[model samples]
Target: MDPVDSSAKSTPGSNGSNSASSLPGVASPPERSNSQSNKPSHIAAHRQSFAENQRYPPPSPHAHRHPSFTQQAIQDLLINPPSNRHANTRYAGRDWRDMALSELVPDEAKWADLDTSVEEATMTLLKNNTSNVVLIRKTSDSKTAISTFDPSDLNAYLLVVVGLAKPNEEHVAAYDEISKKAQSQTPISLREIQTLSRKEQLVVLPADSTLDGAIEAFGSGIHRILVTNQSREVTGVLNQLRLLEFFWNEAANFPVIDRLYGSLLRDLQIGTQQIIAINADAPLADALSLMSNEGLTSVAVVDHGLNVVGNISTADVRHLTNTTSLPLLKSSCMHFISVILSERGVERGRDSFPVFYVNPYSTLAHTVAKLVATNSHRMWVVESASPSPSAPATPLLQASHPVPTPAAAAAVGATSPPAPTILIPPTTSTSGPQSPLPGQSIAVVPSAALPGSRISGRLTGVVSLTDILNLFAKSSGLNPSDPSEQRARRRRSSSSSVRPTIEGGRTSVDIRR
Candidate 1:
């Protein structure tokens, strides 16, 4: 898009009637009324002179001064530089919106193999600074051949898994089982390692497509989408983080402030189905299960009343793995909440956790400001009057009070606290797609009362980086759908085929022409 022109100029004959006023049947401005004739002649002449002066202001009497040599050089360097002209693309001149997903995603060859062991995959993720791994398996289906398929009849079907972060109960158990077999001199099979990895459906788009399509795909609940070449071979993958980086780094190009101002959270399309939450009293295993199963980065923890008390995120899981044993995954969610709250110096009162929330009626500008101040990926939207009056009005963070480090905890004689006991009401049952283990119980909490035991506000929804991109797409007029003509062509060229399941316990990939 071209830069907007700001210089103002007057049209020809704008001060009086011209061709437009002379048009047939065009009415002219009304003449002064007879009552106005009572006004003094000097007063009318003064008014006409004032109007003319206002339209053609007098120029400044001061002479224009030439800039100093240094100032002139600086100005020349900035406006018409003799050097670094090629560096234009290195800065704001480049538009990320026009860039394709393939340009941003890493090469497919760097991805982990489907049969890679848990330990190896974890190491790869840490070394590469990536949380996900593209899992691929060899296939011999001639009908699904691509240009890059190996001549030896070996092609691969791809699935993705969240490979970083702490290992879940199932992953730990699988590792232990495999380790035991290996220690006993028994061989481990590729299938065993693959079974431990939780698979997610891979969304695919063409490599030539713009970022607008990527925003729409992510807004549709996809965590990442694999970019493919014209021959149907995987090229790269675009995830939420990369998309967010593009949005934030190119924020100046977007009119988010103007478009989102005064808009409510509900206008962003948030709903219960999009919320990934766990009961406060539930086990850490349950939270891990939810994250792994859904490929989520965080899960909200709520109380028996369904009020949001805190959040357990992948960062928290990483901290746990670095500081504690893997078995701690079996601990209750309340224990994790306490650890986080205590570390943050949040006192137990009407609200058990130090959660940041905004009202549903809050303006988008307010939300964006809070997001920038907190440096948070997402924030909870709650109803007004959620926190009880008895709850202490502690700020989100105190500058004077330092968070306790490991050494500080030891210096203060603080040790790992025991897990909190929860009394589960019989009426409460397991929530989400995962089922609770036998002998385990869960408390049922209403949506309005889930965050805390106190009379807190209900969790309406959440807003994230993806929502921001959606707003940008709308404001920039980048419609996220194929043209009607292209859609008809695609529909005519499309073929319906069911691809075989790449892995034993994984979902089958649905291939389309």
Candidate 2:
């Protein structure tokens, strides 16, 4: 991982032979046409001057194109920064891509004893405003070993208790039974939690490990990693969201990366269109089951016309940790999402819960900002159903009449009486990993609109923090898709492992299958 030589100069020969390919780690350019040789010397030189700047077309969707950041590309970028970059910003000389993980501050580690009751753990989550708690075994004197648990675990536990207690007097009896169990001080066992929903693997890394290394770990399906000190004591927790936020906050310091912020998400090939979603009218229990079965953090909530209204996330399950909210499981998915949003508003001292979505044409910088602003892990991709296919689609936020915030809706209610309709082409079928693909039909108006808001779009796809981190890793000249190779190379190149063992042993976990 040497910095590329920015001073090198090379010319493409008359036959279009790329001289720069002779340099170490540079790929050969594609062949050129004979017509280029017919041009005048000045024009030919002018064309050749920008030859190395041209990028190869991205691989086809089915093509097995291994991602590689060539030295030549790095050199070109260093020599000439992208035109979109902010001109007054000064370069820091050192590449932020190679910045150590310890440089970026992480949230303080939160833990609970394994013997702690489920009710107590719920209180920890609420009080700390954290989504998860690490459970550790404890003796009379000290704590040992660790396992992760979150709101989803509580939901899973309640589902089991409620299902078994069903119809002794309808769901009411089951609800009461769950309430009684929730109030009990029964210990949360590691064995029982392990048997429940598949948990996201938690790994440990030394505080000195590079941010790019963490990116590789996350790309390999790890949700978070614990940062440990010299004594192997857990100091803080680092996750994809925090890592992304760090990059966004310091974009100007890293001019090389800052220039890429303006690229459209579609052009960057950064998101997935294969969305897993639930109908708004379906029972909340079904959505929970879908998430646990699919090992997902959240699922999009779509209306009958397949238009996205909101989402159901495991994080939202925290609101249901209490006995009072347990019965929400039997409620419609839409109502359940509404309840979660309302509760979140109360906690945050605001009543604004707008739908989170992005258009395909959104800039990567804008997408990351939205994720950080909303404190969300994923954004639903929504697209307008325009009457003319060739016409440009304007994003909801960029429109002349932007969707009003909750507070402003009342002020403008008189002028705009009719609700703005969110249009989606009618679909006779559904689409998702667990459902059939949707078929095209005539445009259909949404019947179940979101309460107190006017916004319109059809759900098209999803993009997550992991996808964004993978892009960061790739841009930093690390291939995140192959974590093993990256780790192996890192080990061979460095004197020791990222987490070196001292008097206390290095603590790390690799539970990914």
Candidate 3:
């Protein structure tokens, strides 16, 4: 196959070209001091001779008064560019000129053997501050077992899997029911939690793979990919969040719109239209149900007045699941949140749950920096004032509430005005949250709180890895309005073609290498 043309044409100012005078809209640069002309005649003559002897012919006298050929060429390319003959070969080969996966993957990656239980594996992930674990399954005889296990093994001993304490809704619900039924019984075994061994396939690439390949892998839709050695031994794992973080860190290098620098959290379309939040008084079961039904990884916990109190996430849930005395699914979310916060020394009056958040008017750069610094997947985009004390708190989703259909939401005006929809895999049911009761409101609360008083600010929306990726897509010229470009963007954003499957009460993520 012909090598892919990965070259990117540099813009005028980008290539150390002081072509301000040649640019269409830019003002010409100030004239240099004539003191240089006072240099010795010998030095001036030597410089002139050097310029004349250069391989390229000297510019015409009119070049100083008009656009140079190079500038005109650039303008022509910008106005009506030549089609790339090798457009089809964009990702045909691994030639990511300067960027590499090594620049993205962290140095301290955690590894585990197949014998490691889910609890141990999750703790390892938490300790290592990573979202994934590399599973090394030893094999004495490669041929027979490799064929018996998976045809695509490629003699690799290591595999990667996300650290989910409970892989699926079914498992969580079943475990909850069992725990409640047998309250006096012994705790569940650690083995009950799904481990890396359960995953059907692993996404792996050689350590020297290009960032373009990594981007392609992530765009294909898998959450993370494992870097392997020549022997197929795991080296590190690159997560979707990390990829976004990398992009944010290197945003200056990428082609970005001028408006991006001036854009704020509110300016960019981010977060859910209606923030799907839960009452602190609600049962943990309710939170889990909402998460499963809404296809959310985290949910805000609010007070009686719809003021934000705390946040609960998959990580919190995972830790809760491992405890010997797992809280009853019906237990209050506040109790769980309080316990977690206390354990982490996350005092009240401070930011609840150490959750990172930003004001609506905050710049995109500030938001991106916060996300990177916190190593967080999402940040709450909050307002400057808390909900009024007199106002009733937002209604929490109840088991009794029927899932709302689009018609119902439209009739009640519970839904926000429709925005540009990104084509991610459907996370929630076809019929999502129900319309609020006639007078019900969706008031938010401060993500952070003061000890004695209600804090200013209300939760508005969230900016997540998904949103950042969408922004990157738009800024990079993948027009969201174009169907072909949209499809290409989606194809490049996901790492997996097949979604995770649940079988025999265990969820197995199928990742393609």
Candidate 4:
């Protein structure tokens, strides 16, 4: 005070005009006069305001906002070569799973103050390119955090939202009731369901089966194949789409196959060779998430030693969804028993199996005939059980059965008498858990608690399209059997929370999942 250091003493009351904001002992700019009469007053005022701001630090642009990035599977997210942030503690020590929810609602905001942004919401779903996101509807109880993204695979995720309506008791009761209902009353193997519906086939040709033979197999009856050696061990699944993609890209050398035939060979890359093969003992959700992420029809089921066993496909999952059965007799039945005119077989009767099982390693055209001959939806895709989870699945049927001409099964289906229709009783007849068992010990991460030790194969975690459809029926208060249920459910569940968005300029407050 006695002899002021002009740089430090300019502001007597302000302590340390000197920290990082200003260098230690450095003075802030001179204050401006309030007089309006001076010609230079306005400019001085502007400079003073700017200087005042310079003296104090400003808030971060991202302080109130969460930074979002387009990410692949959280494991693949580039943690930082250019930056040093550890993957384990990127955002408040939260893993990618927790980071996803934190972005939707930060902790600082009281429950009511959190108004989720459309921009942030869209970005939150960047990782899930395949599964639908059901938004969390705003409610009196904002404490309900969003359900986590359950992994379907490297490509899929599954979330169940209360679609089309806000939550209510009746909704809970419906799910409770249906879930408790009988799931499997018939001897309906997963195969029967696919056979009864339109069957999808992936083929596997012999290793000696030429590229030309493989191409001929394409578009015939199968969409995929397991290329195997003479002794019948799977080398790789020859994808029709990959061959077609090769043919399409190198069309000059490709033979003039049917354009219709060539199209199936074009690799849309829908299913890649690095198929996410899970241990048969792994969680059902593991298979579910994998297929969901990949958007594939099937997954090769394997054992601990990496040997292929069977494939639990989308067709199997479809069976899980459409468990409710109505009478399915399509044979010319009402007339065959009427006043005996003459016992004549109808053009297309139903008793003889149209398709039978084929080994996954054979030509697909032949597999299709197996599907018809055995009345199967899909053939058994099996490989010998080995000691690891990565082994190729061998189609057991392919190794043992004969792949007859398609005409063999076609002609038989036309001659047999239709079997009598079976009526499915109301769901209350059977007993099961109110919800499909959420897997246990199939830890969110690997269960390496005892590496090289064995685990059982009881984990089943996929939620069927039927499960999705059923959730929709409840929120909308629609009857348990509505067809639009599945469509509406799929649409509403595409977002993370069940909260509705303004669509077609109309706001529908009702939430039906």
- Against the true structure, whose lDDT is highest? 2
Runs of candidate 1 with Cα error greater than 4 angstroms are: 1-97, 102-110, 128-198, 205-208, 228-236, 256-258, 266-276, 290-297, 319-327, 338-356, 365-378, 385-457, 464-513
lDDT of 3 by residue, 425-483 (tens): 11222132221211112111222221322332465566666566555555554432322
* Candidate 1: Cα lDDT at 330: 54
Query: Which numbered prediction scores highest in TM-score against the true structure?
Result: 2
Q: Which lDDT tens digits does candidate 4 get at residues 73-176?
A: 34234321121322222333322211222122112211211233211232233333222221222452443322211111111211111011122353455433
TM-score, candidate number 1: 0.47
lDDT: worst 10-residue window of model 4: 335-344
lDDT of 2 by residue, 313-332 (tens): 87766544433334456666
- TM-score per candidate, chains pooled: 0.47, 0.59, 0.49, 0.21
Pairing residues by index, what is the TM-score of model 3?
Answer: 0.49
Please give, for residues 247-348, the per-residue lDDT of candidate 1 as tens digits: 544444444424455567667554232354676557676676555444455666655434566667654543232212233355566555555544333223
Please identify model 2 stretches exceeding 4 Å from their true place.
1-91, 129-131, 135-145, 164-191, 344-349, 385-452, 482-513
| Off by more than 4 A, model 4 | 1-158, 161-272, 318-513
Give the lowest summed-lDDT range of ten residues in model 3. Answer: 151-160
lDDT, candidate 4, equals 0.29
